[model samples]
Target: MTSHKRKTGRRRAVIGGLSALGITGAAVVTATLLAPAGAASAVAAWPQAKGSKPVPASIEFSGTYDGKLQRHYGTGALGSDGQDESQKPLFVLKDGAVLKNVVIGAPAADGVHCLGSCTLQNVWWENVGEDAATFKGTSASSVYAVHGGGAKSASDKVFQFNGAGKLVVNKFQVSDFGKLVRSCGNCKKQYPRTIVINDVDITAPGTSIVGVNANYGDTASLRNVRVHGDPKKKIKPCVRFTGNNTGKEPKEIGTGPDGTTCRYSAGDLSYD
Candidate 1:
């Protein structure tokens, strides 16, 4: 497959997920605004639309799909909110799958459930009923350029990692939410999860970039993350680590204007 590039004036063109097949430097994602419900701060970093290629035919849009072999999801959706909507991950991926060019308009309990391993690119969520993505039970996954917000049903966290081996998220742009990323308690020593978040841009206020909880045994590395909101009302220690932490203290860069630090390292948890 040949990957073509489309230059639109000064705007950056975003390619599709077909690049996963073998092609590279084609897939792209455009930033969109959050809901108008005073949910998030405004960010005028990127445009809302970018050009890209069509999705592969190996994908489908069923309410419930079990990815025991290999599959892909790249379509509008089916059903309504709480009624088999496309945004909901009624599909189960126990093996592996790829999700691209997905626009979830309705709200659902869980966005995408990765039981095994998965890759998500250019996926957007408009109004989520719950967490955007969840990794649980020894799952390993990677996500890139995921944009969306507006937790109408619940003040849900965007990404939740309960128990997984390795999870990597990059270029994640969150318009607003309760918390950006979370590492669940009850971390198993056998699993020993490692989470790496890079280049995360958020506009959430009065909430921790990472939820404060017993994040045990997991090693988290956050680099080049930027949080925009009221520094006075912002969540302190953007990253929190509690419990039997045997891993290295998280590393972070930049801080909010109100002496808002980034992580809960032993000596670097607080600033003013």
Candidate 2:
């Protein structure tokens, strides 16, 4: 556990898109882009959260989003960490809730938190403060075609998966963050923490890829994932796996532009 804490703290400081289609809603909340010329436009059509109630349907967001940052949702259980009205996340998808076509602005910590079976599609996060997004608790969830510009600091990561069941992240694009993806799992639970990262593109000149990590007997698989480092910077390997690492060893498939391949053993992986 000492190693775990030390690695977690060290990893803490270190680590760590979009798409298209339909618009269905009567109340079109038009919003302008704070972006420069040629920047795409976005709008928020969904209604804001009224108290502690989840919206009946999925939320499709574009442009900028401020969750009010009035409350902090607990780590586990929808309200497990403790239900306080401190500040709520932008959107808390109830079981089966989906958050798509969303782009988070900078100076924000509360992005999207998933409780149970949920899907996050076509989501883009830019300059996130802390965790751009998270998949909390032991549930089956998937993040599809997500993109992240970077994080506010070098200590924050782009995404975290703390669930015990199956978690799939497909078509993810990110750059300039410490750890690209992290997982802190439970040791006592027997359920496996299976994480599959497919079609991922990461460009962290001096950062660590730190893909899927399960300390307590978990497994991670990386396929068609590419990690690029700045030619002039000193960077670590593309993937790092720590902890007891007693589960199935990590598997990485894919190569870098310069013929850099992934080297995987029990605890570390260098994917070029």
Candidate 3:
């Protein structure tokens, strides 16, 4: 069969079954907001979405371990917050994976976060939901791990030395209150180390969802995309570019959508 045929086929992969070296739900997870299902943070007992791309059929992983492992979960959650919706994300990275209609019902921190390394050629996130994909990470020593509360897709930045991976977001969409994707963490100035986004829609009016964040002064690109709100109710700007709201304007990235586009390209966008 051809590559396209395989991609359009079913998904089958090997997930988690054993624990990490010293990482635990109570130890690693200090406190956080939310995250959609199938989040990388929940890799231990990573729950497969009812309608996500199957592992063996379409997925792979690269971390401290070798192959995928399936773990047992309770309430399907992450972070220190007990308000995580049950929207587990089915993370995978294989040669060919086909994702059909799927609905992740819950708040999430991130859908996928590849560390060791991964490369996916034919894949999809068609109809992916972000009930409440939050993008706020707390500091733990100096490593700056990932946060909870909010859905997360493949980051927009990556490196072979740090995290070299290929993720394609095709026919994706969010439904709840959260962000589409972001490159953040407990790092200096919160940089987008490894991640990316492609072809997506955020026609959700329940809450706003951010697409990508080019932290660390990196240039995150958003090619063919569109975001809008309900006709009856007035919503804020589709994009919120924040900065050191010093009442100053962003002198970078197209002058920024006023101060809203937190460009921070120039300096502090504080509100002093």
Candidate 4:
């Protein structure tokens, strides 16, 4: 826990300079700051919570809400962490909302639901329920940004994109998960989606990093991705799919960078 606090303090020191530039700017710049001088071989450690809180119902809010790094889990009606698709989220964010410094513990329910453009900063998930978070904003201009967080134990996806516009994930980490970010494969109201993943650390026992629907014109741009403990390189950086709106499972067409749907070069990825 002391080590976690020290790492967080270092990150916060960098954030103090970048926060004024807003979410996107902070995301872009923080990517470079993650690997500081003399610490290139260091792996990010998972955070330890200050305490725990059980949420009986969803907490919906706008503007900004900081959890102070306390572990928040589900209870009562939201206690189950099963793979049920209808589970409710622990937190709901309105448009332009910002949620930060939150640690979601086990039985996390649906984790979080963003109703519109939102920023999730330093929000870690110890055990992902339905997902770590779901982006549901239905506007071409809406941007869902996730920065400085980590998730583990996700049976399936860590982030589900069921909305439109662009979703940016930066300076994040994930381990023992399924897909990191999956654009909706069977949403009835499908729209062209954009995903930007930068400076993310992915640990093995995981699946693809970004899965996009090529048929829906979804595009994923990956940069500075670091994969650990996968010597065989089984973890794919990007996967393309032929998606649909018929409520059926989407078919995966291909994987890797194509310079079209999946964007990135070999120089953008590193194996650690």
Candidate 4 structure quality by residue, lDDT tens digits, 8-123: 77776555533432344656455546564123445578788999989999999999999999999999989988789999999999999999999999899999999999999999
Off by over 4 Å in 1: 1-91, 137-154, 186-191, 212-215, 237-272
Sorted on lDDT, best first, the list reads 4, 1, 2, 3
**Segments in model 4 whose C-alpha atoms lie over 4 Å from true places:** 1-41
Model 3, residue 271: what's the lDDT? 10
Q: Write the per-residue lDDT of candidate 2 for residues 1-272, one digit (tens) a residue.
A: 99889755643332211111111121011101122212222322222322332332223344333344222222222321112324345566655565555444433345566766556655555554456666665643332223212233325566665565655555456666776666642223334455555445556643655454333434555544555555543444434343333454344332222112233332222244
Better of 1 and 3 by lDDT: 1
CA shift of 111, model 3, Å: 5.3
**Total backbone collisions, model 4:** 0
Error of 2 at 208 (Å): 2.6
What pairs collide in candidate 4? Answer: none
TM-score comparison, 1 vs 2, better candidate:
1
TM for candidate 2 is 0.51
Give one digit per residue, the lDDT tens place, for model 1 in 151-258: 222265766776556565555566556666666533343244555554455564436566323233445555445566645645543554453334443333333322
Q: What local lDDT score does residue 40 receive in model 4, on the 0 to 100 scale?
A: 48
What lDDT would each prediction earn against the true structure? 0.44, 0.43, 0.27, 0.88
Global lDDT of model 2? 0.43
Which one wins on lDDT? 4
